[model samples]
Target: MASLLLPIAAAFLLLRVILSATVIDDLRNLRPPPDFNSTIARNCHHNPSLRYCGNSRPLDEIFKFTIVASHLCNESRNPNCVESFDKIDLRGRPKIAPLYLSFDFFWKFCPLTIRSIDFSNNSLRGEFPTSVLACAQAEAIDFSHNELSGDFPVERLASMVNLTVLNLSYNHFSECKLSESLVFRRFNSSNFVHSGLIPNKQSFAVKAVFLMIGLPVMVILTVGFIAMMCFRRRNLSLETPQLRHHFTTSMLKAATSGFSSENLEEKSDGVDIYRGILRDGTHVRIEIYWSNISTEGMRKFIEECEVLVQLRHKNLVRVFGWCDDQELRAIVTKWTDRESLEMWLIERAPPLKHRLKVLAGVMEGMCYLHKSWPQVGYDLGTSSIILSENLEPLISRFEFDGRNSSAKSKFVYKHKFGVLLLEMITDRGKMGDVEAGKAGFIEHIRTSFTANWQNLLDERIMIASTTMEQARQAIEIGLACIDHSANEQLNMDWIRHILLRIYRASCHVNGSPTHGRFDGDRDKRHKHGP
Candidate 1:
């Protein structure tokens, strides 16, 4: 009996040693050495259950989960799931069964490849997740009708150029100042109805002053007194010529014949543009902002005034003055008889020589603006370019925001200038097509040039072999300007030199006088023109 027990004990001891060795081998295989090269891999290696590594699940399963989660509709009854990876539109969902999203819940589960997110009318709550801003490829984001609170990060939002359509309306957001970037400017008052988004500095200052004073009675009296003084001073100053540049409400009323329908040239975006003649017989364009103008619109009107006041260029439309009386708010600018560039391009395509001359004038004006005031930027487009009575091109409208001016602004200017050049060569009525896709305007031009350069050229104008080389060079310069790489984009000075060279070459090829003589004659004619 003792001998049998001893044999059994020995067998148990051997089995225990084998099991211990197997467990040790398994642990060694499971725990890999730290991979310092990749932080994610290293983290996953240290903790095998990390979610980034699918929490021990297969990578395919993780990807599938992300895709499925992103498409899951918020509808309580029958959630319609979509399979799209780029855009997610869940607009006008039932408010009673609102989709309540938490930052962790969405970020951890949703697909990261989404480019456009539309969560409008979701009845979502909580502050907007800044983590979502890190999605560099996100283009259009609509968060309207949500119960979102806190300050809207306008500056951060503006940094993303890909983010075009941003809707933040009907939210419980607090007062926040918007940056003068195109992103913020694209949104109107409707995008911020319940949200406390201040429109202008004046309103913000007034609010700040009132808050600081705190004494309602004293603040009211002081504000009233200041307003009275300003009204009196404005009336008194109107007698001077310099001050008289700003037409009175009565004078504008008389000029427009009590805002008659005949005076109305165009009506756009709730504003009426009227053709008015001053007492001196000088024609002017008056843009009257009626009460229907939203707070955002009024802010834009003020911004326009501010930008126009600083600009002083022959090629630019002259802002004579503005009227901001109790009953009327209007902007007055010098009127031109010739049609807009869009109209001219569509109705009557000019000759190549004439187009080159107009383009040269535009480049000169752009060069001046770029050099003299690097802080100011123009939104160059066909509609912004107006033809004068002498058929000279005038940059009638521009965008200027000194606060947000940067190296990127220069690139934007160059890109728009490239679009202008494309417009010239193609004789296209609009630049919309060029700016429509991710391939870029330069890519579109290259594709067209590769397919058939002749087809890309304006068919209305016959090209002579003598100036064909110059046209090709001009196109090359334009293509270079719109290069995807910022380092490749030509500087304003270089662009000017190339444009001037092209103009001179065109002039010489057309049997016109040499550079200096022809320019001098043209300048004289322009200066003395009707």
Candidate 2:
């Protein structure tokens, strides 16, 4: 019984194969059903896996598709039919017979709607087929193991946007007509074996070199270069910086017009900051606390100033002197007339270059504070950055960081400075009222950073698209600073350097004047802060 069953199954399979071939030949010669629906229904009944018909079921007319081979059209039976293909896929099928008609007319009038074509190992003969060009939408084409000859369409193949795979191996083809190395960058040598053509492999070799050897070396060299640059700049910035100066109470009072309310610029909860100009034409910002304050509060302020005066960078406000008289208690420093950074960001809507310059200066100031005094930073927000006459930023506040001297405290300043950076680029981020907390504000900014960076920009300022990209780096640095975990390492100096590079690029692109340095004349030039 087993031997009889084996013979019966073999006979059935052979009969099915012969019937399939006969059906295909009949399909070509005989007229198809009156419409595609009957044809698909019949095909599904015979073989469910035919084309797109799945599970032996025919689809509705809406989902029905037409496959026009262009060469196998029944002109007599379908005279009014459109010479167009909707879909076709013949994978792992039998070798194709010769075409029925010319494809020139169809190519001119109809769109070739093929997704892919596989004619590999077809035992085809003659030159490369021009009809293949008609299938412009084909993503993959296989013409390997054929007797195809003549100049291959190397130049034309490069123009196909969707064509990805091309197999021409074991073919007697001519030399590659392309001189550009990029034309065959995607293809491999095996695809053109035995043909007088070579794929451009230098790109892959170069990329491999970069990944394995060149990349690590480049990274090391880059890190060393930045370290060297930062070391030089840091030493230059700290060139024999002396301690603070002390002035008499009489001179401060004279400068502030007897500390009257008229000279007062800003009044905080327990602080009255008076803006004054010296007789020598030097402007000054005088800090004095009173009203709803105890002696301890004043003492803390003095102590904070003592720490601030010990260290100095060009970005920090220049401490001219403090008036420690018999009764008066005040800390004085060289001030800016243009007021705080908050005022400028909110009111002026400064252009990209100015904003970048401010950001770089602030980053520099923060880097110095974190590096020089690990247990220090500020907490007063954007109001802490006072602007000099040349519109340069000068950090004016300091937090002794006695409350939290952990690693978080060191990064807290970085995070705060990041917030300032976000504010610099955008105006619609209702940071305080809508997005209340630090994390909330950062989330709001993140949502605003859509594909279009232009929408979030402060439109009051004019800048080019490239400048806008630089502005994007500022926001990224801000977000990175805020989101970085305690364990994550960051390079504050490198960040500062990146910001300065952005400012310089923006300046060059926007055709703005160079950002000024804190020269000796900066002391001579008076500034009154907000």
Could you give candidate 1's per-residue lDDT for residues 90-199 as a string of tens digits?
67764422332323334444545567767788777778756556555787778888788986666677567777677787788777633333445666656666665545
Assess candidate 1 and give its TM-score to the true structure.
0.48
My TM-score estimates for the predictions, one after another, are 0.48, 0.46
Estimate candidate 1's RMSD in Å: 35.4
Query: Any runs in candidate 1 off by more than 4 Å, and if so which?
Result: 1-242, 291-307, 402-405, 427-442, 463-466, 486-489, 514-530
RMSD of each candidate?
A: 35.4, 31.8
Error of 1 at 8 (Å): 99
Model 2 lDDT, residue 131, Cα: 62
Off by over 4 Å in 2: 1-251, 277-281, 291-302, 323-328, 403-406, 429-438, 448-454, 461-466, 511-530
Question: lDDT for every model?
Answer: 0.64, 0.62
> Residue 99 in candidate 1 has what lDDT?
30
Ten-residue stretch with the least lDDT total in model 1: 521-530
